[model samples]
Target: MQRYKCTISYDGTLFSGYQVQPQKRTVQSEIEEALKKLHKGSPIRITASGRTDAGVHARGQVIHFDSPLHIPEDKWVNALHSLLPDDIAVKKVEKAAPDFHARFDATGKEYRYFVRLSNYKDPFTRHYQFQYGYPLDIKQMKAAADYLVGTHDFTSFCSAKTEVEDRVRTILRVGIEMSREQLMFRFVGDGFLYNMVRILVGTLLETGRGLHQPEDMKTILAGKDRSLAGKTAAAHGLYLWEVFY
Candidate 1:
């Protein structure tokens, strides 16, 4: 058997999420079903770098799967593409190191969130970005994000549904950029809890809207209470931008 590491891009608008479900379509289920078909009904499972919630997209998501078939790396991509749906595409596939694991060996990840700064939503980007209409103060948001750049217990930013109790994680960077129509929030971190990125963005948005001071981020983090943070931003506006091994 050989392990193949594949990078893929997907539109998650219609899927339940990345994981498999009994009666719902998911990214993993789709890819595994294709693999099983190719393997002549033999079951095949894939391990992804991480899971994305419903309505979240991915630009360069990675996964590794062990296969008994000895297909060429280039042909693997073509074979999978033929059987996969239009929303998901395998970008590249190659034999991976024997010990490599898609999720376990990951060193870092980067997530991006988009919010439009317009009075009305654009037809082309309505599904891709949040339509926040209000003016945002980038300076205040930046100041708030600065406090999130180091290692800390992020209990406040995680979702209540998360079962992981070790809330400490390291954040490498938090940055924001503006275009003609929207604002982009980028987060590079060692790891993130469930809904952490969305919650962090929501908190920063409050600061940008003058509802909270920049220094309030420090207090929020120190409090370690989810209720003290801002609302969880919509999942549709977020993307799994990259993963580092």
Candidate 2:
């Protein structure tokens, strides 16, 4: 058997999520089903780097699967792409080391959240961005984001419902940039808890809107209380941009 790692991109619309679920369409299920067809009706399981929530898209999601069939490395990408739906694409595929686990071996990940700053929502970008009609204080949001960079216990930013006990994670950086009519926030971190990026973005938006002061970020981090943070931002605006090994 040979292990193959694939870099994938998928449009999350019209699908449940990345993971498999009973009687529901998903990214993993689609890929696995395609693999089954390639293997002459035999089931082939795949492991992903991580799960993206419903409506959350991915540009560089990674997965690893072991196959008994001996298909050439270069052909794997085209074969999988042909089998996958139009919304899903296997960008690249190569032979992988036997022990190269996608999720466990990941060193970091980057997520991006896009926002549209306008009163009149553009139908073309509606599904891709969050439309918040108002001027955001970009300077203030940057200051608030600065406090979140580095190693810290992120209990306040993480979802309270998560059972993960360790909330300590290292944030490599937080960046914000604006284009034509869109504002983009990029979060690169060693790891993130459930809804962590959305919660952090929501808090920063609150700071930018004058609902909270920038310096309040320090207090929120120190307090480590979930109730003190802002609401969770919508998942539709977020994208799993890339994963770093």
lDDT of 2: 0.91
**Alpha carbon lDDT of residue 226, candidate 1?**
94
Worst ten in a row by lDDT for model 1: 120-129
What TM-score, computed on C-alpha atoms, does each candidate reach?
Answer: 0.98, 0.97
- The prediction achieving the highest lDDT against the true structure is 1
lDDT of each prediction vs. the true structure? 0.93, 0.91
Candidate 1, residues 156-219: lDDT per residue as tens digits? 8999888998999999999899989789999999999999999999999989999989998889
Model 2 steric clash pairs: none
Those runs of model 1 whose alpha carbons end farther than 4 Å from true positions after fitting are: none
